[model samples]
Target: MAIAWYIMYRKKRFDRSHDTEKVCPRADNHPIRINGSDSSTVLSDSNQSRDSPRTSEWSNMPQWLEGLRRKRVASACGIPKYSYKELQKATWNFTTNIGEGAFGPVYKAQITTGQTVAVKVLATDSKQGALEFLTEVLLLGRLHHRNLVNLMGYCAERGLHMLVYVYMSNGSLASHLYNEKHEPLTWNLRVQIALDVARGLEYLHYGAVPPVVHRDIKSSNILLDHFMKARVADFGISRQEKSALHSSSDIKGTFGYVDPEYISTSIFTKKSDVYSFGVLLFELMSGNNAQKNLMEYVEFVALGVEDNEGWEEIADPRLEGKFDVQQLNFMGGLAYNCVNPVSRKRPSMREIVLALSEIRKPRNSETYRVITEETTFELDLQGTFDSSLTER
Candidate 1:
């Protein structure tokens, strides 16, 4: 049986690389001895032979793979080389799929260390490739803030590009808002989440060396940890601004959340992120999806305001007289300013942060209630606008 196995292995080697004569006896059969070590004990079927000396052929592996291996070794000393096959096994053939995004499918992986991680695999045919991957790696690699998602590491082996990120237990804010089973976010919690997101954006825009513009900012990209604290995720579309020369080649972001000025002019700025933040603010206040059919409602409100009419009817039904009217109005007003047709008119991220911060301050109870009640009247007037002429 050993001799027959040797013959088959020889034939396989010759077929694989036409190097049968170079093959060692131990390579062809289990329990075969090489350098006084049993082949079965020294190496597995999937890994390179431990007994085999490093060969020149090993250098012929893909450059990206070699670079990634070196990086992994430097970052994590004493860790075993995690080959693609090993990763496949760790992920159970990539069967336990968690979710798919613009990048690709993400799977939950349990490594040998017993630590669980989310593995984001990039599709080979994806329009965005190593560039996006590099963007994420470069940005997240340097950023270690609690408000920002942590990147565990990445894999670039044999055309397979994957990123390993710290898994968030609660998923994304978008899931919480859209998921039917999930409870509606309380006003205070919503404000807190908004504040957390603001701090994240502030960190990126101000804390970094050269300000970073989060070209894409939406509920889906805001991940929540076990404590429900928001962490900004998905830096694929993010870019650093040095001197205002437009860096991005394409206008990439979710509709309704993207800044109108940035979309029209193809220019990315911190204010663009602020605009998106405004949309998020609206989402939180109204308890409504920005992508929903709210154009008519927005237009009606704009028109009503233009004609000295009210707009309380368009307010989110879920709030149901529970929200502080003053805060709600401030939030709505901020959202309006954020989505303003002119980019210059939009509030800066700092301003947005300040405005949201003010909502946390104590206010006169009677005045607050009055402002809250008047929202209904204002919303009613907003419903009368000419739907055809309103800008969404």
Candidate 2:
């Protein structure tokens, strides 16, 4: 989004004159490239270069108070701050409740700039505290990718905090999977969504300077935009690692998707995220809720066969034999490896992306061309791993 000035509060009143800036245009549909520069590291006082975007005043903010005013102001500079009344008006007195999250209820609103957005209000009793809120703002401000949802603006006043995000017309992948109102997702579309998520995770793990661990990865957290393209959302529990091998004792994640190793040892790493992704893949394949009987059925079907042979039994019965047999077998094997008991045995996101690309390739050149045209992505299905893999 285009930059907006800070919300300077005075006598409990907000000066909202500078809230006119609109979010940047939506990402274009093209074959994206996956490269290190696709992501940016959170700027710290020590990392500011001469050409850095920070102003002198911002750079000179009190370093000792990193936990206080400095961190808030510095990370919040480019993001627009909306007043409570403005967001209330946008959300029609918060009556437009579309869904509820762990943090709070979500509302669909159209901001003054004519941009439709989703407003996530922080519930008073939310387990996600102020620190987690700040972490979400900081991470979304710095990290930008097509697969990641865009944060439009925020509200912090009147003892309340809320985040504004570009609204996704199709809602969540979870809804599409299990909701009877919506038609079942086609086999090709599911594969495309899986690739979208894998590329996003790849960016967080390897592309970002200081890698990020999503901490929470579930079907509900994966949203689809107007074109049915997927984006990874909800970063309240995410953490940035100083190095690739970062671990946290706090075990935070959804019940079905949580890594067994992370729960057992209380150690969370990138592989923990991979474990979660594996669960998500299975959900995509089976069109079943992870928390319900999905895993149980998978384990049962898995025990009856060797490797990926019998995974077709677990495939969504709705598909009704429409998916490619070879691809399903390959994806089953790949997803199985991802949820491996030993974290180290799981394939990295980078590897998963490449494997998915292969699995997603069409059997013939004509079909490949037609599919690429529909998605507007120039994917090179020949395994070259060209610039398209890194193009953002």
Candidate 3:
């Protein structure tokens, strides 16, 4: 496909904000959107259907990414259909409520085989509507990966709707970070989780033939299994981004995590996910409630990268000086690239995974300076990124 001049890029944009990937509604279809608020409700990607009608949004200009290729094909996965009565029995008539939101209450229950699962009850009158619900079922039913939450079954019985998922015993990453009851995550654990999320996003953006845009990627959306492995959850607002500029203007996302360019142009691409993930990366490093907005904080750190001033000041105090200086610095640089004001400048999730894989713990304090002092990764960022993207 030939590259069309990007209307969004023509104006030349700077000053970006961090927010989740979201869509504004199109002319014909008005789906109820879920806010990207933080929720520790484990495996609870509720199809919460309260009808909050969003205002009409600007139609994003058709901007074809330069040199970007689109490859996609249709594929289907088999999913079991469960009776509402069976689910009702499993949850004792919605008695074991673990979490609740716009999608309705999520109940922890047991099926006949004595397996525990999370049942997200969807509201029939939800703004998300039937089409979006079916899309979630079809999408989640077929897509499976260790880093992604699995959809076990569904119940479209009577006037009630629900989705069944493998239970996430360990809960969400947010619960571990902000919640004082849980222990603070070690630096190594944080790095590993970041890698897991990067791979998951890579699969969605590149693994899928016609890449699926996880319109919503945030800390709350990342669930941890019993093994403490991170699994990307919540396809409540996900959709496929075909080659052409999308016909609909349906932007959906949480406030703090949304990309600035996405807000300016209303044109979302795979890089939109990259921006949100950048915020997540920053959140992991700072160990703060990033949903409150981290643009200023990220900028503050990015500006300090030259002399390495205030590195400790920005790092999560919870770390207590236990982390490897090299590892922290490397991850911080990667975060800066991901959150680069220009979406095109952000490193691809594939690149993020490779970078993390290459960054290992330093041998000892004797070799720490040599390992951490090298700006090899920074050089690569400059070498690989489009120079124009770095220009204001």
Candidate 4:
């Protein structure tokens, strides 16, 4: 009896040691905050204990309960991770596609809360992969501005991923600019849109904590709200300025709107975005799509011209001579400087904002303007383009 009791004690001790030695390999798979400062509530797959497999843990829980647990975990982080079923029901069983993007198809849906939102689902064979999708969610989750699109939630389940955003009633800027079905944007409205986009870019470049470079900036990526206010959207390819500068990633952007310098050098910077914005400005002015040889058209008109001499020729014919020619000349010069082959010559977004504000100011209202920057020079609003206009 004494020997048997001693054998049982030895077996119990061995079992405890064996159990303690086992470690789950996927413990590091848990979702982490973007800042990596905390290990609190996040929305990744739950970590299973060494004693149980993840399949068993999930299989033991009811489907609805498992979903609720996910929602709660994600909600704690201020960004909810939704289930595929919830999104399917909201999006009318995935039949409400409103648009398609490089990442995937976008659908319009009204959630149970009666809030209308745009859902972007990742396509199986899309060029944009899981990394891009996660980048957008993490970046947009924290970055917020009046000019930037707002991210509402996300869905990652059953080998699917999606992002939700506030619904823009007026659709994209491209629709109004090119689609005859929609009315053309007015001159004043166009100027306002330009300022809106500039402000958005300015915020990303300077206002954000570490600064962000919107690698893709084009008319289609700019959305308009119910008030026709323009907001920059589609951050799938965006990157923080620091990471972008250090990364050796392939160049990503629309063809005609891409920075010429970036294509040759394979180095994308904030100035690259400025170059794209310059193209957008020209597109707005000419009422031409950038993909359709818009740059060639501008080059033809600007070939031998010094100072905005022939800028009037590139004006959108739809305007029918209603726009102020001075404004046109000034905008053309500003845009030309933005697209300058030398990226350093391009004006910063802050400077662009100031210039646009000056352009927006009524000519008769104030001739004397307060100069904020230490080294400030004036561009005669009434006169033609001056090289010093965009110069520091």
The TM-score leader among the candidates is 4
lDDT of 1 by residue, 1-392 (tens): 99999999998877755332222112222222112111111222222223323233123223323444453233321112356776787789999799988899989898877888888899878766776776676556555466788788777677787888888989999888888788877777888888788877766765554456787888899999989999999988677653233645577888878776776677877778887887787777666787885544566665555332233444666556666655665556556766666766565554455546656888654121112111211121112212222222
TM-score of each: 0.70, 0.75, 0.73, 0.78
User: How many clashes (backbone atoms < 3 Å, residues ≥3 apart in a chain or on different chains) does model 2 have?
Assistant: 7
* lDDT against the true structure, each candidate: 0.63, 0.70, 0.65, 0.74
TM-score of 4: 0.78
2 versus 3: better TM-score goes to: 2
Off by over 4 Å in 4: 1-72, 75-77, 247-249, 304-308, 364-375, 378-392
**lDDT score at residue 102, model 2, on the 0-100 scale:** 91
Q: Candidate 3: lDDT over CA atoms?
A: 0.65
TM-score computed on alpha carbons, candidate 3: 0.73
User: What tens-digit string does per-residue lDDT give for candidate 3 at 264-319?
Assistant: 77777788898889889889989877766576877765665654334445689888
Off by over 4 Å in 2: 1-75, 243-249, 363-392
Using lDDT as the yardstick, the better of models 2 and 4 is 4
Off by over 4 Å in 1: 1-66, 69-86, 247-249, 293-296, 305-314, 365-392
For model 3, the stretches where C-alpha displacement exceeds 4 angstroms are 1-77, 124-127, 308-310, 361-392
User: Which of the numbered candidates is closest to the native, going by highest lDDT?
Assistant: 4
